[model samples]
Target: MHRRALLAALLCASVPAVALAVPAPPRRVVSLGGSVTEIVYDLGQGGRLVGDDLSSLYPEAATRLPRVGYYRAAPVEGILALRPDLVLASENAGPPQALERLASLGLTVRRVSDAPSVDSLYRRVEQVAEVLGVPQAGETLAARLRAEIDTARAIPAPRHRALLLVNRSGQFQAAGRDTAANALLGLAGQDNALAAQRGYKPLSAEGLAALAPEMIVITSASLQAVGGMAALRASPGVADTPAARAGRIVPMDDLLALGLGPRLALAIRELKKAAQ
Candidate 1:
């Protein structure tokens, strides 16, 4: 009898206690990225969003939200003044110290990954939904995004190769393999001639010549800064490229091209048309 009692005690001790899962239902949330803000709105939880970054300019309604400043340059005082219960931010959002200070203030800060691929983008949506207590909404959004992406992928591949450039000042950078631009280009059935490098980086005139891309894509903001496509093509090093030769340089809005939000599907569609 004593032996049985001992065995029962040991068994009870060995069995781990099941901890209850805590539900995350933040009443007042602040978003620190344009993409994050869009996700919050898509999830039908826009009412919960108390503030947003300056770049959260889509949905037209989002612009009416209280501004929390730019993501990278967020003002700590402005954020603190909002007294947000939870802060949803992109991984790229911040001065590290500002994030630390918010945490120290007993605020729940969730840093979301900046997913660059389609799969990763879905995962990000799911993550945000989970945080917002609306996983079903995320699944719905992911399905729609997947279907749209599939349609884009079904388009005929462009015969001409293209180079995607992100210009800063006079320095020119090209997107390489495994980048967000490369992934989008692949979905659009366009060949990224500069697929050897892993990410965007400065390339020399000789490097551009070696890649011999048939077309060029520049952000409209950069094009304006560089005195438009005509001036870009007139540059000593860029004038000889195949893109210039064929007059296939295309300028698109930077936010439309780089912002990985609900509107990315639209951007992909526009890119497909541009490639043709």
Candidate 2:
């Protein structure tokens, strides 16, 4: 036989005939954020979720999952014990050291960015779906959410200006442009009085007085901390504000309003009602 033919025959014999190897799917998944957990369940991968952060309270079933501690202060040992093949977390998840430890353990950790707007919220869903190998499911959910948001936006703009306040430990925090509150306000066809600002920041008494929003929207969880609507109105800084003077303060569930998950449609509806 010719040398070239002999070489070809040798190569053919050396390469064994076999089926291509298929990559194994992640069997055990750990979700480290409330929104992440919600998305995983929404994607129909709830059964794969072996562990979840304490904040993953929605969907009822998530509560029964193994608790992995708080989003930011997750216990590395507990996460490792779950033997998760994949870890889905929010961008803000961790004290840095904990995330590093998890990464060092060869865990596949993916961080989904927090969505502060309707568009960004859809993007977040898409991101989660991609990580879970369910891009179609993500697209379907995003489309549905977009339709609801469109319906909400179709409502006529409210006559009143609304201010969204994020109350934390009795301090007043204002959500500005590019925030979830601002997006919800837009969807509800209401103006964000603080739209000119960049992000959530502490508002000084003078700053509150200057804005004088027509309506005040606060997180329900902080109602007690801020002494409720009447007390918020009586605050020295906001006392003279239009929202305070008119007694138009509205309190909403923090998780629903801020989660930026499937409940965004509901959040928009409630905001629209509040605007009216």
Candidate 3:
């Protein structure tokens, strides 16, 4: 068994029941993560979204909301200008001080978990629902998602070694353990090619060749960044890989694959198909 399988087993076995928070529902809300925005929309509280951070581009409506800068670099001025009473942020959001400033200014900032695991995904939905003052809706949505996920997990996908690549400054960074891509691949029954490592890291050409991924997954955004499939396949190490020779490169939605949002089941299914 690979490292990711053991990690997944541990993660699934160890996840505790998430505790939901209780807070008054706000009339105006700003969401800082794509997953959080999707959860808010799933909870039937789309009308409350007055603003969102740069990364909350999902469900069509979230893209129309006023932008408050990138999630990691939250701009207090941009958020305050929206006059939102509640802010739903991913745990990865902000430089810390921005969140503190918002809280200090009497804004209700609810930090939703952004851990790239199944339990954390569920926790995010419940957190958003609780903040929206609708625990029942959260429960209902979570149950449906759980059912969908269980069905996807039972699909019996091939146990191929898979690599999810993201382009960063012209270098290809392979997704490793603790990444959203890693968690999704494991759930989809694919072995993470870089499971021995943690986080995305730029790989040397020899390093990429050695991992020997059977399938290569890249987000649409990353594909465009790296100048499309031909260019990607022609990249130094990839050209010598079995995946490249077999033409098993797949491009998918970044939000679904990496955001670990409401479409996690779909992401799993897509990955399972990619593994074949």
Best by lDDT: 3
- Error of model 1, residue 258, in angstroms: 1.8
RMSD of each: 6.2, 4.1, 14.3
Full ranking by lDDT:
3, 2, 1
Considering lDDT, which of the candidate structures 1 and 3 is the better prediction for this target?
A: 3
Ranking of models by TM-score: 3, 2, 1
Which tens-of-lDDT digit does each residue in 64-103 have in candidate 3?
A: 8888888999999999999999888999998899999999
Q: Number of the top candidate by TM-score?
A: 3
Per-residue lDDT value at 87 in model 3 = 84
Q: Model 1, residue 53: what's the lDDT? A: 89
Clashing pairs in 3: none
Q: Rate the local accuracy (lDDT) of all candidates.
A: 0.80, 0.82, 0.88
| Tens-digit lDDT string for candidate 1 (1-276) | 999999999988766543234544898999998888888888899999889988787777888989988998888889988889999988889998999899998989998777677777787788889888889999999889888877766766465688888877678899888777787667667788888778888877777777788878887777888787778899755787887887778887665666666667777777677767
Question: How far does residue 251 in candidate 1 sit from its true spot (Å)?
Answer: 2.1
Per candidate, the number of residue pairs that clash is 0, 0, 0
What TM-score would you give candidate 3 relative to the actual structure? 0.89
TM-score for each model? 0.80, 0.81, 0.89
